[model samples]
Target: MAISSAGYEGTVDEPQWSDLLANGGGRQYAVADAASWKVTAGTADREVRIAVGRGYGYGVRDVSDTVVSLTLPAPSSGSRYDLIVAHRDWQANVTTFTRIAGSSARSIPTRVQTPGTIDDQPIALVRVTAGQTQVTEIVDLRVVNGSLAFDELVLQYLNRLGTKVRIGVTEWDRDVDSVGNPVWNRTDVTPDTGWVEATRNGGWAFQYCQFRRVGAVIFYRIAAERTQGWGAGDNLAIIPAGFAPDVATYVASSSSRGQGREFVFQTNGSVDTAIASSGATNVTLIGSYVAPR
Candidate 1:
């Protein structure tokens, strides 16, 4: 027999996957099956929408003859978030994944929370039925507050499970924090040894005020060479990661590496660099803003 996220994967016949949505006066949603859900062509359960409010529900789009689509609601900004998706049937879990290649089958429920919630959480769980083109889709999506208030947004399809589909939120990098924020730049070079302290001299730009990893060892140095003609450390040494030191926030200024002289840093993982001072020449104090690789 065939199977879908709406059903179970193995001999149990049926599986039940659900979520306990904490609607901060909004709706909630979760994708049970993801394999059969297709977005490109020749599929079903193609899209999704998650709703948040006093009552939580989801909207699914049936695409092609085999694809199904759905959507869920976004949680309130700056609020605690928790979501879980699991297989409905326990017995079928094994048979559900037996035939799928490059797939992992497990009875363990997949739990997701803000990054800090758990220690090394797997992105999502997968299961496939034997001898079937089983696919799964899970989605996690959020729409920032706009003029017109809406409860939900559509998420891009992720992967497939048994005969159904799965979708989840796509991870992204975004600019945050106001300029003029003081920060210290530190590559993995020397933890507290090298330091580059800088502030928003002015300019609207996405500065990488933090880094987490950089290869085996990140090499960074905070340098301020005293210009020969300029007296008493006249020329600035390094411009912080995201600042155009010599320009106003709204005005176009010289590049961060102007005149072929600037501070250099390397990072890969979580690192923090802040705007230290409005104007300070010569001395470049560097420190570990965030952990380095």
Candidate 2:
């Protein structure tokens, strides 16, 4: 029978042909059967649904019975399918099918068709080999150029058994040393002590400190304000615990005035001695210390 709509020209079953002319409707037919129909002329758009059975619906052939081969429509830019169902027997073991207009066809399973493992959770894409498909949870996934923004980050280094090293930023204060010599002692500034310690020479204001350890090498940055002034042979600051310099050497050019005004990490203890400079000014000490683990 001939199917005729307002502008459709095609052949269909007598029942469908009559319905098309009487109600100006579209039709759904099996893909295999649609191959025989042709649209000669039609200005009005009509939809002809094509069904390719793959055991998902009632009475459809079981996906394991025969592999189903389908030629998918050319993909559009930025288009993605949330679900794709297929068979493994009809054509071969191949399941899903995808094709872009200008790219090679991809047969791998690229989407989830139903809720898997966890209730109502969709499974990610997976590769299926021969035989019936089996579902498994995806453990690891990687994305290129992906960014994760976080308010804070905690980094921990662990040994074979447990955590070994932990690094983080903490507030410290400058306190008077036990020897009564004006020394910068790293103290917990919880009560907001202002981190400033007034010594006989000048006042040392502790700004902040960053500490990190890589293997046996420890790196530190200590920033402080030098008020009043300092003279030669003054122990300005003390290295934090677990970070005493291994050798007795001076960090030259550590001051704005340069060379002669330097700092030395005493080999005997964690004390940092500042070689007398011309005047007292704000200073930042940044250096690496070799400490045994």
Candidate 3:
């Protein structure tokens, strides 16, 4: 067999079973990773397979009956990648997978650890692709015993790398007589109408959060107040003004000044208010970490 050193950059939307049948080849590579294909109506057309280069081997750390752990060395720092662990049983699903350095999971289609009955299934590990000086992401995925059978594991690297973004925030209580809904016309800040801006990044990400829908919804907790707008014996209930015409529950009346307070929405409560708004009022929000919601 001749050797070529080019990269494949096309999208692969085929099922694993069909690819396996078409290629019928898996013994020439130095590294290997399993790929799970979906089956529908007995036709396995599209497949999702892992492209592992030669000479790469599993860097296994330790393994238990239902749990296996390993160390993943990245090509560069700040790169996004994913590690998929396949279980034999569909019932045996991923229980939990936490990054060592507090990188929270952005989204998950299925539970990390779920029970399955399918044999030779594959899970995925996806992280943003980037170049950095230090490795900031380490993760562990554990499956529940007796939930599913065991199979091969797959690691997939995502295209986008995780870029660092800094943020800051400030909280204040406003009179709920009216003017609670901020406008969404553009990125420019509006007067009196709530608006937000990115402190950096050439105004890359900016979002404004507002409380709209009434009915058992907590807008925000007033931690401090320079003006007695939210001080002792204040009757301000954080009433929902603009979009929220209905009356909502507001936790007011703190015993002392500079005390700890929090707002929570009850279970099954409605938050029919927009977290953002715009108008012709001028207000300056002094804070950092202005992210787009």
TM-score for each model: 0.23, 0.29, 0.20
Q: How would you order the candidates by lDDT, starting with the best?
A: 2, 3, 1
Of the two candidates 1 and 2, the one with more favorable lDDT, higher being better, is: 2
lDDT of 3 by residue, 17-123 (tens): 33332332321111121211111111121112222221110111111122223333344444544443433232432222222211234333242332223322223
Candidate 1 vs candidate 2: which has greater TM-score?
A: 2
Give, for candidate 3, the lowest lDDT window spanning 10 residues.
55-64
lDDT (tens digit, per residue) of candidate 2 on 111-219: 3222111111111122212221221111111110111111111111001122111122222222345765443322221222122222222256666545555545656
Question: What are the root-mean-square deviations of the candidates from the true structure over C-alphas?
Answer: 18.4, 25.3, 21.3
In candidate 1, stretches whose alpha carbon ends up further than 4 angstroms from where it belongs are: 1-68, 71-84, 91-216, 220-233, 239-293
Candidate no. 1 TM-score = 0.23
Model 2: CA > 4 A from native: 1-202, 253-260
